[model samples]
Target chain A: MKKIINDPFNFVDESMEGILAAHSNLLKAAEGNVRAIVRADAPAAHKVAVATGGGSGHLPVFLGYVGRGMADGCAVGNVFSSPTSSQMKQVTKAVDSGRGVLYIYGRYQGDMMNFDMAAEDCAEDGIEVQTVLVTDDVASAPREEWQKRRGVAGLFFAYKIAGAKAETGSDLSSVRTAAEKAVSNMRSMGVALGSCTLPTVGRPTFSVSDDEMEIGMGIHGEAGVQRCKLENADQIAATLVDYVAEDLPFCKGDEVAVLVNSLGGTPLEELYILYREINRLLTERGIQIYRPYVGRYACSMEMPGASLTLMKLDDELKELLDAPAETPFFVQN
Target chain B: MKKIINDPFNFVDESMEGILAAHSNLLKAAEGNVRAIVRADAPAAHKVAVATGGGSGHLPVFLGYVGRGMADGCAVGNVFSSPTSSQMKQVTKAVDSGRGVLYIYGRYQGDMMNFDMAAEDCAEDGIEVQTVLVTDDVASAPREEWQKRRGVAGLFFAYKIAGAKAETGSDLSSVRTAAEKAVSNMRSMGVALGSCTLPTVGRPTFSVSDDEMEIGMGIHGEAGVQRCKLENADQIAATLVDYVAEDLPFCKGDEVAVLVNSLGGTPLEELYILYREINRLLTERGIQIYRPYVGRYACSMEMPGASLTLMKLDDELKELLDAPAETPFFVQN
Candidate 1:
């Protein structure tokens, strides 16, 4: 494996150490728990605390979002593995204010189980905690089974709206409502040109022939709905956009916040190309784009692919989306 | 080659179209010249314009930096090729106010030739233009011959400082001096585990064994000073830091800004891990880090590697670095 890591076994720990060192001004390890990272000014009084956690490979996700206007804290885990409930509870306690905490994350089995358990643990300590699982990958399930779908890049929308609500001193239930609304109005799909290698595995998680592409692949290399000969950017964009837009039934005059996210190895230039096609198609369909973000917001480690996310926006959602946010990985004004 | 692109010959044009579509609020193609991109609010009266460009494929480098408090315009070129002098001249004219324009880019032969010709072209048109060629890759030349070195991630430092200076209404000479000083005090070196493929080429630019790495490789897959077995992140960090530090002869009390830039395929998590080691070694050497940035600030399309840049800063550079700036690819407050 051509990874620049000291020990594959310590990849998660070492990476967490590095994250803290580089972003010392913005983040800090939760007191007494290295696996839990919190904003340096966490536990602010009377504000609803927002927290998320998941596997470690996706930077700017779980940990990178913990800052002033985003998640107040995040529990971290090993590569593609969920953080322990203990870690989650510790993070919950670290960031919880008098208003309580809201837990948001992708709808993976391991993640759901851990966060659920942590919620129960926090309850015993009189710390109110609510959960909102993101289910926005349209290809992972039919419309009737949307709750079964996995979360993808659309989680960023959830983070933004929910974090913005919590930052406004909303209660835990209000924050949970905003997060659920964000997830309910979102859809995402991806096309993977190549596989990613987990540091621990020391090899690619999966493989694809040179001329093939996998559509709707999961962030952790989960099986996609289709595998076919590689296609050009326009075709790929059409496939992804059609699936996501149709799932949401986005219509003429509807506004959206578009995220053309890189899946690790895809360059921003390509993402913009995909975004161009997406914009053209959406415009043709008469859908209005309120805001468009193109970059690596979420990613698998070194996977060559891109994902498209469309979050149908309402006035409240738009206001929240446009609210100022500052984090190591993301900042907006 | 598994890249999400249309006809190879149309890659640059298509990507530029996408960029204009996604960032129309912040940027627009220059009138009468699609290959020249300018800020939507370009030609701000009496403000010295800052512009930079080179070969394509490096996102957020040339065009992505054109926005408020950064570059005012940038010339676009085909992948791994310099923009024509005509295109540069058009962009210079598009952004220049009464104060003048500053041209900054890497010291590649094609870039130098084209930019020099463009400067002359602008002179003939009575639009004052000054040039500051970035030479910061310590591995490309010895200290005595630093002017012959190639630019790398350190170019971002030059952009930030000079852009900030220009945004403050500095004159052409002042902006030029800030850019030159930034280039003079900066050093960078990279290690590539695999080569990046140009869209038009449709194949890897160069090849390396899975167990080996090339140190100090250029953005376009140019040869480095050494090729050896792949080393751990700490060892790689030490080698890169040692080379750049020794070249500057950075003193024990020097304060510097550090950038751990991903060469496309390397994930931010790995860059942070690399940054951790870099921080340790620099601190051990008594070099204090002022501002640290770790991300894909500069890239060679999907190449599996990273580069380290150190910009030794004085009070002026520090103030300029801290100035607020907002662009599609970068934002600071």
Candidate 2:
């Protein structure tokens, strides 16, 4: 109930204004739509324009990835809400480099409907636009119904691979193929021990007993698949690891890069603890780790949980992962 | 009192062991000193060696900086405790190429004494070593007694500049000078709204009322300069930003980098809120920002507070920041 903002309704917009001001040299505001964001150094010479959009809370994820070797542009919505079709169309035009634009976003209702409409709008304007829904979370649905699963942190892996191919000036078909490769090889599952409340909503999105943790909570405070008595770090890691392994069915000695991410409020101690167990589980199965990143990659606001993302890294994927990138949200080498 | 460690006494060691295992391809355990960590591909032909070390909790600061274009080696101590002199000596020996070693660490009594003794030990072993301490918090004393102020996140900025120079194979003296330059130009001030319980101690380092926050807190849950009633984000940012600006005597048209770091439990929303005020305050002074990083850079186990660091950068600092570097912890471009 207590905050210093001039208006709670304008929190996201005013915050973006400040962000653009600070990064004025590297970022710029899109014309017309307040929520539309594009790279200040846009139209990077004939490259396929890779654009992503989503709600705001999981930063650097949707917008932070808009930089060299990554997303070409981003459509940012209010916190936990999807951007309008008008905003999406603006991004489609802003990132267009005379080739095409690929609309990449998670599988959520509002995002799907608005982005779908935006695609039609772009076509009407003679701008070629293609869409790809990154639904890599295997916990939400069976493999046969993978398209219905919610997209989560694993979308980042797809973005990196696709963006690299796009930056190489690959045609839309090749870029799409690369993105699909990354997404198909990726799998993520999360467990929320607690929930996060949006800034405007002063109460938590979901709730569980202090001793019980839901095993498959969506990143946007969506209903979890199941809940059980709390378990130890090793047990939790084993649970998620087993699910991902069984779903993906990677053989022994397969190379993978692991991401053990905190949803928000979990401490580093807990992440490292989970990382320890995850490493043991994977190594015991003869998995070869290319690089292990155990930190908050994409976090829900104040949510107490962790997700495991395993991407089967190929040479191209490795190259993209190795690409040097910088943005307000994520910096990588 | 709940944690995920097997034994409280072995928490740091076990954590280090896990880190080594996860990073073994990039780092290794020093032969004689388990506390010292060296790059797996060390003694990089003739580059000057850069080594850093401090207590455990302020992660990604001392240990995470050990990679290409950063510290070549590091020594990690127990929670809020300094590594032994032997560990520092081992780190120096491991990193020492023919170009000598530069030692950079936060200002702490135990770390200072131990590193000094280690320098002497390295001297006996015919290895040259130089040292620089970051003590930039102004609230500990006025400018006349700046050295008495404890070091905090400001040290990381020093590390970036110094490490960049070291990566360019600068002489030990040049690297030391750049580090000192960064330290001299940097100023940081922090407040603590809560405390961090040491893993072994199993109790909070200090207590705070539900409506209070301590101003000018150091990294290791140390006492702050003043305890005051809790205020909104803008007021807190104003308090911190005013202190940092006044300490630096920054003027119009000055270009500086700002870091708003969360001390653990504070969410990104709060950090961003704090960041909004910081940029506003600096811009009002006609200052231009080169970079603004707001997140958990140096977290202290579940402690609730935010620290603001402002570094008036020179062309050289900006170039090094623009340089490409990669490590397990941070990647900069």
List of chain B TM-scores, one per candidate: 0.98, 0.97
Clashing pairs in 2: none
Task: Write one digit per residue (lDDT tens) for candidate 2, span A52-88.
Answer: 8989877657876777777887888888889988898
Best by DockQ: 1
What's the lDDT for residue B280 in model 1?
A: 95
Tell me the spans in candidate 1 whose CA falls farther than 4 Å from its real position.
none
Q: Candidate 1: lDDT over CA atoms?
A: 0.89
Task: Please provide, for model 2 over B23-118, each residue's C-alpha lDDT reduced to its tens digit, 9 standing for 90 to 100.
Answer: 777778787455799888887678988888988877777787788787889988888889999898889888888789998887878999999999
TM-score for each predicted model, relative to the true structure? 0.99, 0.93
Candidate 2 segments whose C-alpha is farther than 4 A from its true place: A1-7, A32-34, A208-210, A314-324, B1-10, B32-34, B315-321
- Write down the TM-score for model 1: 0.99
True contacts kept of each: 0.71, 0.23
